[model samples]
Target: MRLFHSPASPYVRKVMVTAYERGVEDQIEILGSAAGPVKRDPEIVKHNSSGKVPCALLENDTPLFDSRVICAYLDSLAGREGTVYPQGADRFDVLTLEALGDAILDACLLCRYEAVLRPESLRWDDWYAGQMAKVDSGLDDLEGKWFERISGAFHAGSIAVVCALGYLDFRFSDKDWRSTHPKLAAWFAEVSERRSMKETLPKG
Candidate 1:
């Protein structure tokens, strides 16, 4: 498989991490891309109309897209279905957890664009605050409700949470999220030592 990739994209990281966990990273060819909301990469558009990272083309030239789909595909490729993502009633719950993580990332990327990409004269404080509120709420929900899943299993949901928190540290290091989310912080510190997480640390 070939992947349109951006090192700085957390969604891309999600696919990469899943690939590593499935022992298929060696099989993927990384295609460099400069995907952006306004300035789309023409190369990526060939595979994904949205021009998004994590878009992939299989050996047979079949296209797959978005991090979630690609990660599931990787799980299948590894013959390890129902592992990172489970089967039955547990699947939807895990998918919901992944959605929560993605929502946090969505809000985070919006906040990042407002701060770095938007012009100073037009940046909205209200928007930034609202986005940060989502991040905070997400962290709180994970701490209160998903702590057991996060602390116990090595599933896709936990991977999403780790990548979300990793992005927070990568982009917003000055923000002291660990002070309140101590349990997550501790879990992250341990998980960071994993080969997959260390090798796939986000870079621009």
Candidate 2:
């Protein structure tokens, strides 16, 4: 299997973390790719229409796009039953949390691209502010509603959340989000120590 990835992509990191936790990291070969709204890698585009990182090609030549789909597929490949992704009612909760975490990353990435990719003259202040607002609201919700749920049992939701927080720390450290969400910060402190998280830390 081959995984299209960018070192600094939170989405790619999630997939890598998933592969690591599933004990199948060694089976996948990482292929660096440039993926962004304005810049696309043609090789990646061949596998994923969106030209995104974290796209995986299975051993049998099946292509998997999107971190969520790739992670779920990897879980199945590892014969992991109801672990990272639980079944029943717990599944929905985990999935919802994953969505929230992914959304946070979306906002953060958009804000980053706005500042770093777009020319100063073309950048829109309102757009950057809007994304930051989403980041703020998402962090607040996580701190208030999901802080107590964080556990040592690594799951898709928790993995996604940790990766999202990592991205913030990597790119928006000046925001001091940890100061406002101490519980989440503490939870992250522990989870970030996991071998998967540590090994997959974004390197820009």
Candidate 3:
């Protein structure tokens, strides 16, 4: 399998981490692909219509896209049933959490694009604040409702949350999220020490 990856993308990190947890990291070959809203890599476009990084091309020439889909596919390939993703009703809960984590990342990435990608004169403070509000609300939901659900099992949901938090640390270090949600912060600290996360920590 070949993965088009960007070192700075949290989505890519999520897929890489999932691959590591599934014990399939060694099977994947990473191909550098830098893609952003304004900057699209043609190589990634050949595999993913959206021109997104973290797109995987299987040995059979099958293309997988989006971090969530790629992670699920990798999990299926591992054949480790009921591990990264649970079964039955529990699966829905984990998937919901993964959605929330991805939503948080979406908001954070949008805010980043607004601040850094857009020209200063064209950047809208209100738009940035709105995006950040989504992130804040997502964090509040995680801290208030999902705090006790973090089992340190390194499942898909937990991995997504960790990657989301790591993205904040990488891009919005000025914001002290730790003080606002100590429990979630502490949970992230513990999960982040896992070998999978440690090895896939985002860089650049």
lDDT of 1 by residue, 85-149 (tens): 88867788788888999999999999999999999999999999999999999999888888887
Predicted model with the maximum lDDT:
1
lDDT of 3 by residue, 20-110 (tens): 8889899889898878787789888877888988799987768998899999988998996646898866678888889989999999999
Candidate 1, poorest ten consecutive residues by summed lDDT: 80-89
Q: Compared with the true structure, what per-residue lDDT tens digits does model 2 show for residues 2-80?
A: 9888899999899889988989888888887878787788888887888888899976867998999988888888885
What is each predicted model's overall lDDT from 0 to 1? 0.89, 0.87, 0.88
- Model 2 residue runs over 4 Å out of place are none
TM-score of each candidate? 0.96, 0.95, 0.96
Measure candidate 3: CA RMSD: 1.2
Residue ranges of candidate 3 with Cα displaced over 4 Å: none
Question: Regarding TM-score, does 2 or 3 come out ahead?
Answer: 3
Q: List the residue pairs that clash in candidate 2.
A: none
Candidate 2 displacement at residue 65 in angstroms: 0.6
How many clashing pairs does model 1 include? 0
